[model samples]
Target: MLVRQCKSNFLGWIVPLLLLSITVHTAALAQCSPGAIICETFGTGTRGQLPQGQTNFSYRAIPCPNDGEYNVMDTVASSCHGDAWHRVTEDHTAGDVRGNMFVVNASYQPSEFFSQKAEGLCPGVTYEFSMWVMNINKVLQPGPCDEFSLRNPIIAMRIEQTDGTLIREVVQPAVPRTTTPVWVQLTMQFAIQTNVNDVVVKLINKGLGGCGNDLAIDDIGFRPVHPTLTIQFPNSTATETTVCADTRLTLSVGAATGYPNPVYSWQQSQDNVNWTAVPGSGQATYTINPVRAGRTYYRLRNAQPINANAVGRSQCSAESNVLIVNGRPDAPFSIGDDLALCEGTSQVLRAPEPLPAGTTIQWSDQSTNRQLTVDAPGNYWLETNLNGCTYRDTINVAIQNCHLEDIYVPDAFSPNSDTVNDKLVVMHPGTFTAYSFRVYDRWGSVLFVSKQADTHWDGTFQGQPCLQGVYAWTVDYSVLNGQNQERHFARSGRVLLVR
Candidate 1:
């Protein structure tokens, strides 16, 4: 038995090579490579049914139909394609196209075809279409030998524009005649001619029928030869930095090259792992108004690529670095609403202690010190600036007056032992610090004197009752002014002494 494989170069020439029987047998177990944008393995759905996202080509042979025009089959039948058909499973290169494989036969005409439409392809972008195929022949009644003469079959793969114009076409090496079928892997690389956004990929089995046009293909894949997509911050420092609360931050994406026109979206995350899209952030630049504190992570996500083959989505997306922001502290101090001071005294107003570092204190008088002294009263305030934020508090102050006329003294007292009118006293409206009262007789001699404010004068001289007559009295006292300063007060008045 002879086995051959073919490869096409950039110029579209088929280069054939020979393989030993042992090498051909070992090739049945080959697996599909990774990185395909679309891989139709036909692993889903029941046998004899069409796979999802695919349909049979309109062209079909009318004469010798044995089953549905297009069907998926399992590797349970011995005479279906070849003994090696079961080895060609979906991802595995060997083992009957993994679970189920696509099948088409040319029972009436010399060929049969199946096609599917592919959308969102980049114009003039090179893509590789790959699949595995095997020839099927009828088995005799007593054994797995062919009932008719053995024949080789050819498989052609083509990409056509929506209008059915061919863009590129390549035929796989013919499947050689053998008692047991052998699976061959085929790949064709092509680019769309014009700006075609949609194209049809068709796989056709071109071979003579009688009993030899049956073909089983599996593990189809379509992908770009080179996939490119990238996202980065224009300013490297913006990746990991800090910001102030309510500050607006603008983040822009770095220039991306090689990828087709790509769509962008901005996202934010607190943990840097789970991300959510920021509304209205679908442009190349995004802005943030951080009204709160704590750390936030941001990244630019490549949402859709002009070339569908490019990779940039959720886990595979390009992300920016992290940002940490801080908010302003609360008002630090409480200045009482009202403050009082004497007319001639000064009072010092102090700011709250243990102030935060980098704090700036300003007074209503434009003083930068943390303490201010005021004598004249009106309104005073203090403003503190910390971490780029400001807070203020105000106080009202009033001045008080102290006068001598505010004190009153009684003019007369009787020493007759009656409870009423038995003592001489001085009365004042305000608080006094010191007070003294003195009484004199008609002969101009001092009779009684008291040093305490609450003490009173009784009508007596040297332990003898003085005659009841007019007596002279003098009183002195001191009171605190508005500024807490003391002022002296004195007065003299005549009083009548009665028995």
Candidate 2:
């Protein structure tokens, strides 16, 4: 009874055949961007012939190509795009458009393969491959024994040289038997090694078959990959071209995609004609230590070429705009040696002449002017910076007190208003803080008094010309000493007033 039931179940369909007529709504085709070297949709050309640039096995039965026997399918149930798809088959769909499926019967053959040759490929160029595949196993009734069960086929996409040597392989798990056909997408990316010009893309079916080994492929693509490299800092396009001298500058390189270990070499030039490589400056980032002064130029070169293709040659090198490093102005500015000033006196400190354009001068007191008026005695300094270097100069200033010995007082004068020797006056070389002059008569009575050191006695008593005789006059004054200390002084003398 068990044997009878198994046999009956094996002959009956698992799913109704009516559903096979239902069409599946697949997503839109994914195509490579512009500039692709090769993009094959298999949508053009006659149904029975291979794609425009593709070929099939030229040999006979048994031990056929590993790509297996293939054809174009237009059937709604198997096609991936608008009415067409590339199908691999074992027998039923041979030389006909009715067969829109790829089948591998490993029970009769061990290896079956399909291949397409892509030409004009660049040497040492990166490319991407994309395609869609679907497993087309029909649901069958239960079998009496598991010996006739459907076997999933292992599918692999390979990139090969002209001699059939493998360059890269992308393998997919065996397609499981499904009630409804389902499309699977696969993508592979690789870089062609140096000296390689052309490559063949092969799809191989490696599976033992007694059951389902059907597959459908569509929308294949091949295109060159473009990687971007941009200079980030010390932007060459900026308006300002000057940088500080003696400063450490950083050059940065940025990438959008591509090389995993990109190599960089930085070079500098004075005249923009002859460039020299900077030692130890090979990386994504390079720092210039103590940058030189004057106008200079910089450029970056990719030591490790990302792609050998001529298409990317321009991106491999970048030239920066002119860089002008402003150096510090000359040092040792002459503001004179140590200087001395009397109390209440000021001296002007002037910066050296012939200042460079864009040079800035700053005094120790934070004054940016070219000259500073300093009254207090102390150490005064000036700093000048140009292009990024700083130069400094300093001078010591001494404040001293006034000395009484430097003062002269005349004791005799004629009040005849002759303009000369008309009055008794006190004169001093330095500034005076306080002064007083007084005259006394022979009777010891005060006759004239004055408080200003510059004021003079007219040899008068109460606005009246005094008689020409011996008169006693006294003067008092105070002055700052060498230590800025105030000292008082007094002098009394007898003067003869003449009319």
Candidate 3:
């Protein structure tokens, strides 16, 4: 294999440099990777309102908050010693006033300071949850709260459902006490394994307060992180090459680690726009047979399943760069090319219409005909005997599945959290080559978007519960046609979001 496997090093800064928007620290979230969307920026200002419905603590308009209370603030206040403590002057967002950040004093017991629910999210995708936080407590020499006695800031972040079904969790254990404020980012990436479209996030403070358990946070975001894939040739980094006909070549694929389990499929194409999968070519390495005299393209496709036990889909899949192989034949003769066909479909291969007298033709199948209809994929040769001379030509007929399929959707669903039709699921046979689903409000606001055929809607938008009414849904998908071709389809309908 020419390509080396990409690995994730959570302990190093390189991973963040590759996957996160912030490269200043060991941030793990897919911060600014492609398709990343910020769920919350808090707000912008020297001091902004404490985010409503996002945190459980009481909002106090003070630079320093009391136990079970928090406020978004800028600037600072004197410490217990009446002296200015190690305080942050601004927020975490760059180029802006560092503006304001979440300032909190640890509660007596564990409590969630931030809670949010996101719905209509796509399925089978690896999403990264991240936030910038800092331990704002300062240790003054000859002070009451010594390093040994002061408790460090600690917190737990998790994703769950309304029914309290735990999906995943990441614990900071403890944010080390610092003399000066240092903003660091913490991130966690995981896959959505089920059809449930509602994902709830909670950040709980577990530190005990009295002296030195204080923290500030900013730039909380959630986004998708897909593996980077590449194809390589042995002893070469070139993506395109010219070789003689009948030349054998070996290619390998490599991808970054993070996704649960990813499926690999090798594809071939004459024009880069249209691709056809090579039958049984689902491995890290693929061997190309003797090249035919023509220009051909090859690439790798990667699809990660929702979890280890699930099948992968193309909606959130990754495609590799194309590798062009131009074949130069020692003996050049043009037999032309056969147009691709759908599986179980037919194509007629006709010989020259104005044939010379005394001309006879025999196909590879031993059938004598001027034209033959092929329904399957393989090589077909035609031998023409005319003027006491014979000529032979071959054609490789491509056949694949390109059938358009539909998804089953209900006219309405109840999201009362009663677990009975609580979501509107876009049901399909799970065989689509590509798929996308979306739900929209009457005013043209998008409520949900799904990448998998089995995704659903939880009747919520932006952490706010939606009212009972009719909502529109649209679906676009592609299925296998003959010759591994993709047959595209689209559908739309209205459904009631009953409370």
TM-scores of the candidates in the order shown: 0.42, 0.36, 0.45
Single out the weakest 10-residue window by summed lDDT for candidate 3.
8-17
TM-score of 1: 0.42
Q: lDDT by residue for model 3 over 146-168, one digit each (tens)?
A: 33566767787666775788876
Tell how far residue 432 is off in model 3, in angstroms: 51
Off-target runs (Cα >4 Å) in candidate 3 are: 1-43, 74-81, 120-127, 141-148, 166-170, 189-191, 194-197, 221-228, 233-236, 239-301, 305-315, 318-499
Each model's lDDT:
0.58, 0.56, 0.66
Model 3, residue 89: distance off in Å is 2.7
Best by lDDT: 3
Better of 2 and 3 by lDDT: 3
lDDT of 2 by residue, 1-499 (tens): 0011210111110100011111232443434335434444444223344433343333222222223344453443333222122333321222433323222333334353566655544444455555456655555553533256555667666667779887776556666555555555555556656666566666666665444454555544444444544544565544234555656777666443234464566677887778787888767677777666677666665523543223223222333333334433233356788888877899999998887777788999998987999899899998887755676778899887545446666657787877989988777878778878788989989998899776778887777788889888787888887677888988888887877
Error of 2 at 131 (Å): 0.9
- Residue-by-residue lDDT tens digits, candidate 1, 1-499: 0011111011111111111111133255433445555555656435344434344433232322342254554543543444322232342244432366656555444443556666655544555656666654433233323345454467666667768887766666676544555666667666544467676766566655544556676666555544343334446644455545444667675554333465666777787778777887767777775434567767665523543333334222333434443344534676665876766988889888877788888999999886899898799999887776666788988876535347666767787887998877677766778877888877678898888877777788788888888998887777786567888878887898878
Tell me the deviation in Å of residue 92 in model 2.
23
Q: Top model by TM-score, which number?
A: 3
